[model samples]
Target: MTGSIQRVALITGASRGLGRSSALKLAENGVDVVLTYKDNADAARTTTTEIKALGRQAVALRLDMADTGSFAAFAAQLKSTLAGTWQRDRFDYLVNNAGTGAQVPFAETTEAQFDQLAAVHLKGTFFLTQALLPLIADGGRIVNTSSGLARFSLPGYAAYAAMKGGIEVLTRYMARELAPRGIRVNTIAPGAIETDFGGGLVRDNAQVNAHIADATALGRVGLPDDVGGAVAALLSDDNQWITGQRIEVSGGMML
Candidate 1:
């Protein structure tokens, strides 16, 4: 096992939003990071620079979660990166945080939309994790991103939330299967936040934001910090005993 000071994490979709925040939070705690971005190389570079400024090693790579065919190549590239950069064979943590949002009502949701959600949120996560398993050290950690919509009903989010629900179930299965290797797998189901996800509905629309705030016990919509901090804490060694659980960082929504 790598020493705590040398621990590294691979966070997907980390160019911005929760992933970016999580990467920074981890770096704040001395964890090196390799982050992935879908399209924005500039944003990814900025994240790496910030991590480097924090005195932690950082690398940014491109990854499209919806494309499973590219996972093998990504995994290969990751292996080379680990050797060339960190001189290590495996990383200590994996944050499967890359994702897209869908808001079509169940009745209006098309099969294409459903498939895209499944590909990005479920299939891609499953296979990418599988492909990267050999490079994840024993006693490592995995955090799969979920959504509060999976636990509570929210119209127009049926398809999106369903995929997250599947992820929650998958987390448990991964925890069970990977137990012998000492890998802990868990899910983080975040409440609506003010990110660019889902066309920024919750962030841009005052009525929607207010409605969410009223429903939440915290009386405010969540921010990237709300979730990124929780995820950072969860992946810390202090919470090693926790696995196969769904930790919702929703400020007590629907309670």
Candidate 2:
């Protein structure tokens, strides 16, 4: 887009945590945002209010990542939203950041838990992007959320990490196929952060937080803004040459 046209971004799971921070950071950088939340309409409204406070247009919509069947409807709604709000039919950036957390050992992990993780993180992301392909602008960018666990060995994360690993691979393939449209696809892997994910183990538990901090090269667990800033940087015009790479925003964790 030209300097005169304000760009728009659609971020999934943006009601709170890293997603919320990413939306806010993009807003600070003068980008409008279309944020989605799974079940918390109030949080989504609050985020949009804050984005609008930053002098950028913002809207909130409900989206359940695990429901593949709803993606078509979601895309239609998104198209209408874009037309109504911006007088356009496409958005410039897409952040596939919606997901749920699970920490179950491989031996004891139930199929139900595994299915939920796969449905939300892997299957949901895959099909949702496919469903939204037409609505994404030709030169747009897509950021897929991965996890540091995919690269590092951790117990009770076999299923979750596996899904993330799949996401990393999918990023490479997406980058390759979508290159014709000048659409860059990359992965962002975040280390332990003090978020509500996984019951906030790293954020609320002093012992766990201290342990993670000790292992991290930066001497502290990640915050939402840590990842948010990296995401904004990755999607910036200056980073056009970079794609299909996994950029870890873990503050040098597990180095």
Candidate 3:
């Protein structure tokens, strides 16, 4: 953080949606990026290209958050990428934002569904951060994605919210433990947005969109840029003193 070199951020699920938005926002602030995608190579490459268009270095790497076993290899690849692309051995920001959604009632939610949620949202974030700890610079930041569902009641999101709730707690613990190293850890909980998440239920469903808009104080459902800008602000030097907190980017939903 003390050098003239531009800061680098590693953002997961940056192929599209909030992740893609976050990547571009950071790039706009002169931060280089190393982003990941699960299956969409073309979209990931497009995000990298867009970042380059912003005059910042960017790379897209394939990653499966649900597959924890692959993390070691991924970390190795990242280390290599960093040395080769940026001539550095460490990155400054780690954004744990890769995730999927589950929409089943508590009573009907299968064990598999719950496990998948835990694997991607909770376990993956935890272990992936652990794996990359050595490569993250001393005065770095970590932003883990949470959800408004964790704060307000929402049917069909019990499992997903539970994992995010765990992430909120984990953020505090990470902040405390990583304090000696000057590593700040926080969580961002975004409200319903018009994304492809959960089969675009909030984006494509007219009734659902209107319901969320009416419930929100802003009188509109959230958008990718809303959360993206918030993330860029959170990771900015202006908010360096803010850590171990859950900042909800929900447009005052369910309030």
TM-score of every model versus the real structure: 0.98, 0.99, 0.99
Model 3 TM-score on a 0 to 1 scale: 0.99
Clashes of 3: 0
Model 2 residue 112 lDDT score? 96
Off by over 4 Å in 1: 2-5
* Cα shift from native, residue 186, model 2 (Å): 0.6
Worst 10 residues of 1 by lDDT: 1-10
Could you give candidate 1's per-residue lDDT for residues 1-255 as a string of tens digits? 645448999999999999999999999989999999999999999999999999999999999999999999999999999999999889999999999988888999999999999999999999999999999999999999999999999889999999999999999999999999999999999998999888889999999999999999989999998898998999888887999999999999999
lDDT (tens digit, per residue) of candidate 3 on 95-137: 9999998789999999998999999999999999999999999
Query: Ten residues in a row with the worst lDDT in model 3?
Result: 1-10
Q: Which stretches of candidate 2 lie over 4 Å from their true place?
A: none
